[model samples]
Target: MIPKHTVDRLSNRLTHLKPILSFEIVFIAVFVTLVFFTGGAAAQAPVGGGGGNTSGWETILDNLYNVLYITLQYAGLTILVLGFIVWLSARNNSQRSETGMKLTMGGAAMVVAYFGLGALVSLLEFIAG
Candidate 1:
């Protein structure tokens, strides 16, 4: 077993780290928001090209892509925070650990699926064109 002094020291370290953690969180939030807004603006803008005008389907796809991108991006951030919280809690039981793992895996799966679907759609469009 660990000594009480060691535990106390660890607790003190964690307390000291709180401010750094808060700043990291705030920075992440701001960066994600900026990226989302910039990407959204580009997606919303009409694609100016020699393609002789963008088709309705193309416009729809662009909008859908932007929406999906933003949604997935935010969802990912939320999942990460939740997973971190669960991990920080450090449940003694195996069951809780399994639950946290599942949550993280689910979040990862969502990101992969979002990109996969987008790639598939782009491929199909390319082939059709």
Candidate 2:
């Protein structure tokens, strides 16, 4: 049997942690995996050749795509984390209603959109080749 004082302390600590524990865990896990695997290497370039006189529009699109991809990569992780926090809040409180579910779904949608856009870009590149 645990001591009463110890149990009280543990309960208090857990109560305080209830709001953000899920987000923290997800963020830490993603961060650790990325750090261990990638180790700060830059993104790989798309497989293609410049092939004389790339238009201004093409250059602009390429730069925009690169920026969007990088931004989505980081932002997706953050949304995943925020979704977790919202999930925890919903779980702990009955008043939260469907907001947490919406957040989680929205986060998932952004991740999917990021990948979908990447695939679309790749398809366009393939056609151009």
Each candidate's clash count: 0, 0
Candidate 1 TM-score versus the reference: 0.45
Write model 2 residue lDDT over 59-96, tens digit each, in one string.
76778778889888778767777877877877667555
Clashing pairs in 1: none
Question: What TM-score, computed on C-alpha atoms, does each candidate reach?
Answer: 0.45, 0.50
Q: Give candidate 2's error at residue 39 in angstroms.
A: 35
Q: What's model 2's overall lDDT?
A: 0.76
- Write the residue-wise lDDT of candidate 1 on 1-129 in tens digits: 999999999998888874546877999999999898778654554556646565856777888788988898779767866766675576796777777777777777777877887789899889999
